[model samples]
Target chain A: MNELPMSHHKHNDPLPETVLRVKALESLLVEKGLVDPAALDALIDTYETKVGPRNGARVVARAWADPAYRERLLSDASAAIAELGFSGRQGEDMVVLENTPQVHNMVVCTLCSCYPWPVLGLPPVWYKSAPYRARAVAEPRAVLEEFGCSLPEDVEVRVWDSTAEVRYLVLPMRPRGTDALNQAQLAELVTRDSMIGTALPRSP
Target chain B: MNGAHDLGGMHGFGAISPEPDEPVFHADWERRAFAITLAMGAYGRWNLDMSRYARERMEPAEYLRTSYYEHWIHGLQLLLIEQGLLSAAEIEARMQRIAAETDAGAES
Candidate 1:
C-alpha cells in the first residue's frame, strides 16, 4: 500500500499546475475512500510490466506460424486474441488487419486514443499526437515514410479509425529471410510500431 | 462533441518526432494521472465513453495545448465533479493546501 509519490514537490522550483492538480485529485479520492491506492499501483504495474506490445507480438507470431490461427485471427480477432489471454477494456471488439504484399493497414483514433490496451498496453505518444492522428488518415504513405517505412506506390494503404468499442492491431507480414525462425524467434522481431503499422518488423 | 481531440485530418501540426526510446510515463504526475484515472474508473460511476466525452468537452484551444495526461486529469476532474464525488472548490482547496505543504517542506 505505497502512497502516491509527491517527488516533484521536493524541489524549490514550482511544479506544473497539472501535476499539483492530479496529486490533489488522488488525495481527495483516497481520503473519501473512493479509490484504493493499491488499485492504482496495480493498474500502473499492469501497464508498465505485465501488458504491452509483447502480448500483441505473440499473437502476430502465432498467426504467422499457424494458418488456422491466422484464419481465426482474421475472421474473429477478439476471440483469437482472447485465446492468448489478451482481452479487456478498450479491446472488447478487436480487428486484426493483415498486411499483405499488396496492402498495408494503419490504425488511429481520431476522436481519442482508442487503442488495444490489453495487447498493446497503451497507445504511443506519437500515435496519440495531433500530427500523427491528423496526417495518418490524410497521408498514410508520407506518415509511414516519416516512421522510416516507405511503401512502394503499388501497395494500397488502409487507415482504420478506432472508435470507442473497436480496436485495431496490424499484423505485419513476416519479414523475408526468416523461414527457419520459430514462433518465439518471430515474436522477437515484432516491434510496437510494426504492430501499429507504422514500421515493419525487424529483420533477423 | 467536436473537440480538438478529434484530430483525424487537419493541417498545421508539423512533423512527428519519434523519441528514440521513450519511457511509458514521461513524468511522475503522468503515471499518477493515468493510474488514478483507471482506478477511479472502477467505481462504475462512469463508463469509458462518458469519461472520453468529458475530456472531449475541453476547450478546443486549451485541449490542443495540453499534453495527453493533462487531458486525462481534466476529464477526471470533470467526472468527479459531475458525479458529485468532489466539487470544484474542494479540488482548488486541496491544490492550495498541497502547494503550501510543498513550500513548507522546501524550507525545512
Candidate 2:
C-alpha cells in the first residue's frame, strides 16, 4: 500500500465530473445572459447557511430531552430522525453511535466521503482528508488527541468505516454545564467536529 | 457495496488494480464549491436540500460515481439550471464562445 502513489480514497468517480460539466453548461448560460445569476446565487447561498449541522444538533437535543426518542434514535436512527422531520437525503440508513466513557466511535468514508447526512449534515473538510482517514482507523487515539479530545485509557475506540448500506453519526455525550440550557443553547454545542467524535461539544 | 467513488477492495481486504500516478486535487474547485454554496446558503438564497435530495433520490451508483466536490458541483448546477439562471442553448453557445475567445486570445 505504501508503494502506491495514490491512496484509494481519492474521488475517482466520473459522476462528479459529469456534475461539473453540467455546471459548466450552466455557467456558460450565465455568461450568455440567458439565466439569472441572482437566483442561482440565492439557491447556493441557502444551502450554506440553512442546511448545515442544525439538523444533527436538533436530533442531539431531542435525544437529551426524551429517553425513548433517544432509544429509538439509537436502535432505528432513520425512523427516529424522521420524527424530528430530518430524514431522507443521502444517508438514509443512518446509525447514531453514542459516545461514552466505555466506548467511542468515529466515522470515515475511506473510499470517498461517506457521511450521515440525514443527521450530521455534510462532513467537514478535515473528516474526508487523506491524513484523517488513514490515521483514524490505524491510530484512533492519536487522531482524537490532535482534535483536543482525550479518552480514558479504559475506553475502546471503534472507528466506523462507512459502507453503502449503513451511515454513522456520533451521538456525543452531551457536554456538561448544559443541563440548564434550552434547545437552542444545546444545539449550539453540536459542531461538525464534535458530532464526528473528534472534538467535545463546547459549552460556549 | 458500491457507490460512485468505490475503488474495489482498494481500501481493504482485497487488492485491486492501482491508479496511475497519485491524484492531486485542485484547491480552488473545492473552495468555490464550498464557498459559493455556503455563501448562498448564508445569504438565504437556497438550502442544501438538493444535496440531501440527490444523496437520497439519485441511484447509489451515481452517488458513488461522483467525487465529493463533484456532487456539490452537480447539485449546484442543478439548482442553478433548474431555477432558470441559464438556458440549455445559451450555455452551449457560451462554451463555444469561450472556446473561440480563448483561441483568439492565444493567437495574439
Candidate whose TM-score is highest: 1
lDDT of 1 by residue, A82-164 (tens): 99999987899999999999999998887778899999987777777777888889988988988999898999999999998
Clashing pairs in 1: none
Scanning candidate 1 chain A in windows of ten residues, the lowest lDDT window is A5-14
Candidate 2, after superposition: displacement of residue A155 in Å? Answer: 0.9
Root-mean-square deviation of each candidate, in angstroms? 6.3, 8.9
**The best candidate in terms of lDDT:** 1
Relative to the unseen true structure, what is the Cα RMSD of model 2? 8.9
Docking tier of model 1: it is acceptable
Q: What digit string (tens of lDDT, one per residue) describes model 2 on residues B1-108?
A: 344334322343111222333222334455445545544344444555544444334455555434567666556555655676655666556656656776799999
Q: Give the TM-score of candidate 2.
A: 0.61
Fraction of true contacts retained by every candidate, in order, equals 0.66, 0.16
Q: What's the lDDT for residue B41 in model 1? A: 86
Write down the TM-score for model 1: 0.94
